[model samples]
Target: MPGSAPLTTKDGRFGYEAAGDPASQPLLFLHGIGGAARAWRGQLDFFRDRYRTIAWDMPGYGGSAPLPDVSIAALAGALQDFLQAVGATNPVIVGHSIGGMIVQQWLAKNPRTAGAVVLAQTSPAFGKPDGDWQKSFIDARLGPLDRGETLVTLAPSLVNELVGDDPDASGMDLARDCMAAVPGATYRATMLALMGFDLRSALKAIAVPTLVLSGSKDNNAPAPMMAKMASYIPSATYVELEGVGHLANLERPLAFNAALDQFLKANVTATQVTA
Candidate 1:
């Protein structure tokens, strides 16, 4: 298995960490608001032997350039450009949290761009932006920064809330490091960008083979929400990983990788045969 290393596009607009064989089928991993490219290290290493695995630090995270504005459409556009730059055609996309939202937005615009999609521990909507719940959600996260605390100071508690009841120490450390490294401005922008996101209606139009993976203990994107999300897409398969939390890939890498491998083999093989 190959290790992840920094990679830049020819245009220098995007930066990512890539592993695996360039000649193999591409598998792209997108991380959540609290994550960076390194969040998918386990997946990249696990799948590198069989696929060209790449994990991107979304625009504004890691060394990637920040977008002028943060919104689902804009993020999706950035993803489109990144795909083109990397020469990936109809690759498999494995997205977590907001990363899953980006994949959904991208699929809404380019239904045929992916060979398959894995929506892991994410929701189809953020609920009403003006609703009390939304306000509370945003306030709770932003209030810390408002009080003059940096991400480094808030990372421990934030990550604690996001992980499972019993999480690996190493996974917790990685999550903390990723969250702590995020710039305050970018984190705030991303939080606000998700305010009015709603793609429930567009799920049925996703024509590619899809897998919805959920963590049984994920409070943020609960199993029920993921099940409903899976139901919206035609013939989508839903798998719940017991004892895992929002960071399913990190919390239970072996199980996560196994589920993904099974899905890719079945769906990618079928798609190739039909083509």
Candidate 2:
């Protein structure tokens, strides 16, 4: 019931694409950088029939509006406003990649989350990257989306890189479409925001049943780095998806769904009791 409607918050407007049973529990989904809410289509189709699932497009990405000011904390505050607007007292928040970092920071201020999951990624503070990593926000990969290049011409190359070696041409194509649909200014601002933000300490402050899943082959957020994240979060459960890339949910939907199902089942009962 909560999944299908539009929820307007103090910060901006929020919406979710849902399907599952109306009577089931609620689950909020967050996507990665340059990703739209539809990125969770696999999970939406699988769990919406059993659980009330709602996925969001991050500010400045997908259908969501641009942020007043782009920063992890600002996004976190917007998330809080969204939850309150939607009247989600304690919905389980599930996020991927950069989304995971925002979720962690959001939970630091609002500890009322039923549970949270970090899928196929970790925070920006994982392994010590090169000194220029944080400073370099604009690059050739996102030149079109960040600058003035046309999406029709830029979609192919950028989409191929986003999909990596997923072996799912269809999924890759869909992601490419979403990326192409994104506005250049929105894409650029969001990437700039992600560059300097760090949530290392926020991991420990999160006081919810959390699941952290990493892809072994994820060059973006590798296993060793996520493993360290799992170690930091006192209540986090770590699981690595083998032979998968950054887009684990899309790359290996079966494995991704299985892991998600297990985490939900394990926490569903406890969450009900607490609620």
Candidate 3:
């Protein structure tokens, strides 16, 4: 298990965990609303030998500062700053859930910046934030907090519902720990932020090769929706891991890593013969 002390920007606005050499082509990871930078440990450990692995604690998570306005656009702006700060030029970007949405927003605005992209267990849109389904979702997550259940107290049961029937024990523990650390306010703000995201129109404009990773058992971002999303991207490869749910990376690291590794080799590394 490769790991390191989490690092923060000198100004204290951004925080992340980095492993491997900065000289290497970067492998940047973005975790879901329920997760923090450490959720990417399995990936950092697996890919650090060949790529510079870095995982950010999205604004408001970990030591990162909370945004005055938590929107996709704002997150993307922060992402740009983080990239510039860390000197991650045309990095191979991997984003999961809300992280995936942020990546889409970043690519939508800065189309040519990434060497390749990976969107795992995410959707193109949340539909109208006020719509019935969306409201239900927002309520399901926030209702607990509204009733005074903090993220730390709600994390265990929340993670249990997110994982597959049989998940990796250590991975489940890691996922729980990550979820437990999320700030309650951050979760609320991010949930509302998700309501405003709609990136379907920008999918075809994705400039780099893309990997759309889905989990067959994912109810949050269903497999069918992800498949259709892949169809919209110009150069997209779709891979669905069976028996896994929304937390595919933590639910089944081997299958998730294999899909990611293959995508990087064919779409990113092959292009980066320099690395």
Q: What RMSD, rounded to one decimal, does every model reach?
A: 2.3, 3.6, 1.8
Tens-digit lDDT string for candidate 1 (57-148): 89999989999999988999999999889877668999899999999999999998788999999999998989899999999999999999
lDDT measured at residue 100 in model 1 versus the true structure, 0 to 100: 95
* Candidate 3 residue-wise lDDT, 52-78, digit = tens: 889999999998999999998899999
TM-scores for every candidate against the unseen true structure? 0.96, 0.85, 0.96
Candidate 3's C-alpha lDDT? 0.89
Model 3 bad stretches (over 4 Å): 270-275
What's the true lDDT of residue 228 in model 1?
85
Q: Candidate 3: lDDT of 177?
A: 91
TM-score (C-alpha) between model 3 and the true structure: 0.96
* Overall local distance difference test of candidate 2: 0.69
Q: Model 2, 39-116: lDDT tens per residue?
A: 787777777665667778777765567778887788888788766665555577788877887887777677756555
- Residues forming the 10-long window of minimal summed lDDT in candidate 3: 266-275
Report the alpha-carbon TM-score of model 2 versus the true structure: 0.85
Q: Between 1 and 2, whose TM-score is larger?
A: 1
Question: Model 1, residue 153: what's the lDDT?
Answer: 92
Descending-TM-score candidate ranking: 3, 1, 2
